[model samples]
Target: MTARGLIFAAPASGTGKTLVTAGLARHLRRRGWRVATAKAGPDFIDPTFHALAAGKPCRNLDVWGMRRATLAGLIGELEAHADFVLCEGVMGLFDGTGPGAEAGSTAELALMTGWPVVLVVDARGQGASVAALLKGFAGHRPSVPLAAVIFNRVSGNRHAALLADATARHLPSLVCLGSLPADPGLALPSRHLGLVPASENRDAEAVIEHCAARIGTSVDVERLLRVALGSTLSAAGKAAPLAPLGERIAVARDEAFCFAYPTLLEGWRSQGAEVTFFSPLANEPPGADADAVYLPGGYPELWPDRLASAQVFMTGIRRAASEGAAIYGECGGYMVLGEALIVGEGQICPMAGLLPLVTSFAERRLCLGYRRATLRVDTNLGAAG
Candidate 1:
């Protein structure tokens, strides 16, 4: 049977969409359903929580960065493996990279996959006014499927009743799943990037369980399942997004290097590449026989002391580089490959010295968004532009 899917979106960010999505995924998984979760943008942190909750790796669906075929292939793969798929949207339901551009928005994903959206509205402040908000979202893009609504941070039964009555009166077509109460304990802690990586959170599983219990009790799980629609995507004859680095690739995997995209690795495997993982924080090095090494992005600055003291890991990577193994580093990984890293209080931390570069995190400067650059010369990434 084709897998049914739902897009858990919100009017804006911080509307408890991540917790709700994770909670619903866990709730369904506990009930004997094979639940698969995905984040609907370029997010590494949220997917970690979803993976923890769903007991599987969460793939990212980036409409802007990924081609249509790649997106279809991923959704197809998810459908083939799981009975149900839940996608957590990024930011607001309609918010994207630019004004009126649907490229990176949740609405775009919903429309593309023909998946019904379960709008999670934060009902903390107003009651009847929410009806107007719902109406605007529903009527904004007539093509996007807005199947149901779920009230979050609801005050009490009276508040829920007020919202429900307002919805029934103003928009009789939209379905109200249920309301989750305002519980401060349900909120996840955040850092500069976003929520702290699930691996770093000691009570990650407990937090997921708490969310699952709350959602299972509050939301109408049966109706929510019914509201999910099957994906309209077909992945027949779709090509992999990019070529693998080498036949055998060794990847850095630890708290500091946790921002690797699962889809990219999965694509590499699909293209007949062998991938292995090692932890630099644990003083582990890449496999000796690895033809290529990948150091992904993460909070390397946070563990500069541990990384700097990992002599074994440093020596191993240097050996690999000298032996002509393709070494690729992105963001935090690039920082580790530098000559030194200036972290907290301008402390100099010795790095792998693979690159004549130094990165400083002493004063944070947030540079976010998509970037496009043409390669100047032939390298591991691609040929010259």
Candidate 2:
């Protein structure tokens, strides 16, 4: 039926949307409420944290990558599971691929799914101007509604009071749910890709709990819940599976290869396919009986030495390739499939050399964008477009 949900959004990146969303998920879950989580875009890393916080597998609701039917199917599935669904939005509330485009923005998601947004503002250096910003965002798109505002990185009670009072004076209809004070310990560690995936964060659980405690004390969880539950979203329905890759697919999964989406794998299973996991980082290869192999993106450059020296793992991959097992890779996995990978300080590490491709991490370049590729020939992904 109507699954109460909220999309955690911000004015820009680094506005503490992930932290607030995760903390609120944990806090609400601990208070005996079933919580489901999702990420607004195609982010593999943030969904892991969302899963850890909500104590369930998190799904990705991408506006750009996913078809409307696919999104509807996922929303149906989410509605089937929990009382509340907290989706953390990408980058900024209105930011997307191009100027005036809403394809991948949080605003687009809110407009599509009717999920009210809980905007988290970085209130470090502003006061009454915060009201103007909120008013602009709230009025920017008539179709999308801003449910509440949570001020993050507030200097102190004095700063929080100023922000709250100013917003109340200007946009009185908007609710100030909470204000998180500046805390160094609350910040998560980051690297070239982003925050270290939740699996590698040793203190991840403790960090979630600490954030939850803070959120529980500071945020108006009950009021926010009311706002979410007030929405009249339709019930989730049955979904058909996507095009099948193979009957038995081998998947790479580990700290070094942990970027695969849960929904994709779940879709594979729904199509009556068997999926097995092997860790190249652990020197394990794909199962001998696998019909196809999939390698998702991750930070393989960080573990060059270990990946290079995994003789058993590398040998098995070569054997599988020789045996005509269809293999595909994306980004990091593509790097591993190449002849060599150049990591830090010009240290070139030997890879499987399966493909005549060369990738260098040492010589970094920015290739950021939404990519569209047409099939050159008929392949597992389907016929040429």
Candidate 3:
């Protein structure tokens, strides 16, 4: 969409780009703009927040973990179906490693996407020296267009004007869209992983609404849009999300099984597989009497009673498994396929009974990390040794 483009960034982490991007997306949506939001790294939580703001599924545009071709395809594919693309860059403009031994970074994604940068500078605890920071950021990178600046956490009008004037010389013709003060009232809650999981927050809707209102009122949208629309068009290529599954598979998809990746589903489609989706918690049997069933991760523990009452779904699952339909699950899905899932209320709930396993979530310790796993035997995910 030639309409506009935006990449919200900062000198480093904690400068409020996530909030700014969320707010801007909300504001634009309020202005009747069809906003397409994306994150420039392998973050699950940020994209969740972006989705909340943009009112659409926000996808990740990681250059680091994905094949070059896959990355291009993801950017290009998501660029469709929106009036504008608002990409939120990862930590500071240049904070990332490459895939395996590859050298591509977030900086590379910006160049590849043909989108300009909107620097979000935290003006807190700084004065005229903000100029030096801008100079270093501008000079440290080449080929990345520094479109404009947004001074975040400014103390007051006089403080903002001074910071703007101080940095104006280094960023010739650069417009300070507006300054955001350090608002104690607008901060999002954090978790060990970062901002609290998007699924667990009640204030998320209000947070986005408030931030959007602030950004819409403060930032110069016209200037930002001009810079975004000025970017040269590039071909992002076609990359599918799902991996290749066999001929046909029945995928459990609903509130209980919603953590499946878009890429994985898309990849299955590419492999000429018929991936039918259905709900297990809603008492709906999977679509099609397929050769296999995939149950991905989600909050299955929260609705144990409903899932237990879903006899139709459980029976269908058992029948599918009995017919030699390969059954597989990950995390929560893995827990659900077990014989019983113990709830936090000390209640045991019946599951698909595919396996004689039981799971409990009363003592949850976050299992967070990147994985480097290889298969040892043939499973539904792929060919094993």
Best by TM-score: 2
Worst 10 residues of 2 by lDDT: 229-238
Per-residue accuracy of model 3 over 1-385 as CA lDDT, tens digit each: 3445678877887888888898888888899888888888767667778888888888777766676667666656556567788888887787656334223355666776678888998888898899888888788766777778999888988988888888776677666788887787568788545676566778888888888877777777877777775234336355745455557888887766767766677678877888888889778876546887889887787689999999999888888878788787886789889988887756888887878888876656546444567899877666785
After superposing candidate 3, which stretches have Cα over 4 Å from the reference?
1-3, 98-104, 229-236, 241-258, 266-385
TM-score of each: 0.93, 0.95, 0.74
Per-residue C-alpha lDDT of model 2 across residues 1-385, encoded as one tens digit per residue: 4578899999998888898999999998998888899999888888888899998899888889877767887887787778888999999999987777878888888888888898999998999999989999989886788878999998999998999999899988888887988887678888877788889899888888989998887778778888785224334334545665688999999877888888888889988999999999999989999888888899888888999999998998888889988888888898899999997789989999999987887787865567789999998887988
Clash tally, candidates in order: 0, 1, 9
| TM-score (C-alpha, index-matched) for candidate 2 | 0.95
lDDT of 1 at 349: 95
In model 2, the Cα lDDT at residue 18 comes to 92
Q: Which pairs, if any, clash in model 3? A: 72-236, 73-237, 73-239, 241-263, 241-264, 242-263, 242-264, 242-265, 242-267
> Cα deviation of 342 in candidate 3 (Å)?
14
